[model samples]
Target: MTQKSSVRQMIGFITDVTRWSLSGGIGYQLFLCLLVVFMMLGVFAYLVQWKLGLAVTHMSDIVSWGFYIANFTFLVGVAAAAVMLILPSYIFKDKDFHHVVIIGEVVAIGALVMSMTFVFVDLGRPLQGWHIIPIIGLFNWPSSLLTWDILVLNVYLVLNLSIPAYILYCHYNQVEPDPRKYRPFVFISIFWAFGIHLITAFLYEGLPARPFWNNPLMGPRFLASAFAAGPALITVLLVIIHNTTVFKIPKQTFNKLRLIIVISAIINLIMLFSEVFKEFYFPTHHSLSAEYLYFGLDGHNSLVPWIWTAISINIIGTLLLAFNPGKNKPMLLLPACILLFVGIWIEKGIGLIVPGLVPSPLGEVVSYAPSWVEISIALGILALGMFVVTMLLKPALIIEHRFKAEKPS
Candidate 1:
């Protein structure tokens, strides 16, 4: 193609993306408006945080890490969940996942972007964020796991964006992408996905002072919960797609996802049990964190209800999903999946981070609750992520549907 033709094609691609992204129903419009409102609120709150300092939130010296890092940690896992689909669809050539693999990749992009945002927000010196740049700044790359996290996350973000952009651009132009061009990225992404979450796990486990997070099982637990929650969220999105659009996801796909959720949930629950037994039965100094998380330590039981709620939801969701009856019913399946996702969210969110900080390694029991500002900011970040997911998936579904309709019988 000549330069002029290439430019025209690029313009056309831009037009297509904008057209599809902006086109939706009244409901979609209202949803977008709502997201905009939340984004505005969050931005305003973040500005306040920026001006007044981190004190606007509920974090303290004892609980230096709060909602932001928790979200960053969980979202990194959600981002990694794309690998589950990529590996099977690409390496094993499972055609069932071929179309939806793009969906997972797009979701990864949104999650990763949100994860990066959370990290930025968590930084006390957000303006000096560039200081982490190699050579130009004082980054402890080889000596610091955080530097490894920074590298892997950004690289993973690039891979997720480029792979989909290439594939989706091919679809937009009604062409097939060359496997050799994108396949190696797929393989690298699979391992890179694992590395992102593992590095995060290491960040937590490396902190020997936080006995709650010092467990050797932390890495496996992160992966298990991630695989369960990530696919569960995708399954929920697939159901939404089926209900709203002409595109159809195979029931078999949901069934396969159901199995993944079930197995991963069981493993996660088993890990939970192992932690419980070790903490409650042996009753060591490390057990204080567990006791505080579940039953409260010294009249400070704010997280008790939250932890139990998470546990109950996980159990109910696991049983419902594992059984034949619930798996077959969309009504049951949808709610079960939601429960599983929210359950893991809570488990990993406050349930994972807060307890470790409570009764700090020095036996300081400082309770932390997210102020309205923190909550608003979190809601905003979540809305931002949803908006990204919505916009990215819109053009993808449009192109996929066009291809599907154009295919010869």
Candidate 2:
């Protein structure tokens, strides 16, 4: 193709993407509108936060991190979970996942976008976030896990975005993508996925002051829970796509994903149990953090109920996904996925971060709760992610429809 023709095609593709994104069913439009309202509210709340300062948040000098960082940590795991699908479809050559591997990539992109947004919103001086840039800012590269996290996350985002964009661009033009061009990147992405979450875990585990977070198993636990939560969300999203749109995902593919969710959830449970045993069995100074989390230390028990609720839901989700009855019933599967997703979010988001700080290294107890403004901002961040995912999926679905039209019966 000539350069002029290529430019014309690119412009045409953008036009189609915009049109398809705008054109959706009433239900879709309503959902989009709802998200916009939440986003606007979130923006208002963030402006208030920006105006007043972090003082508006429940975070004190002792409990410095709150809702934003919790979500950020959880989403890093969710973003890495895309590797679960990428491995089977790309490495194992599973034809069943070929059509939906793009879906996983899209999920990764959306999750990363949210993760970065949370990081952005958490900043007191949002403009100074650019300090992580290599040459312009003091990234503290060799010494800081956070610097490593910034590098891996942005690179992973680019890699995930590029692979699917290339695939969809080829499909948009009714041409087959060359594996030679994109397959190597797919391989690199698999390792990069692990690196992104590992670096995130190190960000916590390397903190010598927080003994609760300085566990050797933090990385493994993060990976296991990430695989469970990530695949569980993808499963729910796939079902929504299957029901609401013309896109058809095979039951065999669903079954494969179900297996991944089941195994990962089990591994995550085992790790959780192992931590409980380690914490409660010997009972050291470090045990106070876990004690405060699970059963409450002294008179403080703010997190006890939330932690147990997370555990109950996780157990229920694991059992539901493991059984034949739940596997066969779509209704049961959907709720199980929700339970697992919510359970992990609660566990990792608030449950993981708060305990480490509650019983400070100096043994001072300070309770932290997200104020209304913090909650509003979180809802807004989530709404923004859903909007992006919804927009991205529309274009991809349109391209899929075009493929179906061209396919020979």
- Best candidate per lDDT, number? 2
lDDT of 2 at 201: 95
* Model 2 pairs in collision: none
Model 1 is weakest, by summed lDDT over 10 consecutive residues, at 323-332
lDDT of 2 by residue, 37-106 (tens): 9999999999999999988888888888999999999999989999999998988999878778888888
Error of 1 at 198 (Å): 0.8
Candidate 1 C-alpha lDDT tens digits along 1-409: 7999889998999898998998889999999999999999999999999899999999999889998988998999999998888988999998888768888998899999899988888899977987999988889978888998999999999999999898888878878789999999889999999999999899888888888998899999999999999999999999999888888999888888888889999999999899898899879888888899999889888889988999999999999999858645678899998998899998998899999888886798867778888888888999999999999999989988887777675
What candidate 1 gets wrong by more than 4 Å, as runs, is none
Clashing pairs in 1: none
Instruction: Give all TM-scores, in the order shown.
Output: 0.98, 0.98
Evaluated at residue 293, the lDDT of candidate 1 is 91
